[model samples]
Target: MSDSFGFGQRFTPDEMASIRKSLRDEARFGSEFIGRLKRVAKRIPFAEDLLAAWVCTRDPSTPRRVKLTLLAALGYFVLPLDAIPDVMPLLGFTDDAAVIAAALAAVAGSITQQHRDKAKEMLADL
Candidate 1:
């Protein structure tokens, strides 16, 4: 897992690490954030993929760039406005899904079955 995510081209490992921690910390206590996600996870088409990203972020083996990319994608999921607003009923989550898809593609090899299993566990707990 030495390969860079290639998408997080702007941030160094230290910067990415900081950003990852910041986003994780924000979501850890962010009832509003996690609450919103939990409510939408069932309805969102790519929710599982995004959950994989979230789990991948916490993985010690995930590359820094991948972690940063995952954090950015997940962080975007919590925002009110992005490429498309998350309030448009059905189409709102499309952009978020696309972002996750792209992130997943960028780090194709990094997102392992382990991440998917962890994601499923967390989503079930949610």
Candidate 2:
């Protein structure tokens, strides 16, 4: 069967490779997200949304494909190098923010109030 109900349509080889890389980098996201968040929290305007996405990703009830998409964006955020190197002033995290915004828009319905609340709580503690 060629059906991909839960995951949408099948990916081409290059797309599949990127997905695989995202999955492989999930641990990196988990490990680096907090530290990176702390470092750039003051600079990033969307920290709450980012934390909500992280909360959604960790929720057992979240769909796998949603998790995959969020992880891909989160993974990109933590990468040492990306479309725009993240060390530059002002423009550094624009690409990361764009990627994250796209992922959140794609899975907006899946991110619940509970996730948002948890994210807010985390932000308060931070």
Candidate 3:
């Protein structure tokens, strides 16, 4: 009955509420998070490679649904439109990070050494 099987135990109702609140507040903190992500993203040379690794690791071997979910989450980051506009303050990027983290956790097994290596290579600049 619990979400223990996925993403380190599904978030509790309270946790989910907190996450929602964080998203709401992110409008005020969006800029900071976006800046952080930009800094991090900039360090990685092969962002696509890391993303490929995430896809391979997180989704089931034949994961159509999970793939869609990941794509949607990724789109949320790249797209300008969302519940909280990316231009907001510190919290703007919290949701993006949370979603990406959740997706990564979901497919942790798929993220192999190769993926990590690629990420490391890209991030070496940082």
Best by TM-score: 2
lDDT of 3 by residue, 1-126 (tens): 433235435446785564454445434434543444456575433354435544343435635434444544554565556666656766666667666777666765656666576556545553
Per-residue lDDT value at 72 in model 1: 77
Tens-digit lDDT track of model 1 for 1-126: 233444534767786675666576654635555677798988887777877877787789887777767777777677666888877888888898887787788878888999899878878887
Candidate 3 TM-score over all chains jointly: 0.48
TM-score of each: 0.76, 0.83, 0.48
* Over 4 Å off, model 1: 1-33
List clash counts for every candidate, in order: 0, 0, 16
Model 1 / residue 58 / CA error / Å: 0.4
Give the CA lDDT, 0 to 100, for residue 49 in model 2: 89
Name the regions of candidate 3 deviating beyond 4 angstroms.
1-66
lDDT values, one for every candidate: 0.75, 0.83, 0.52
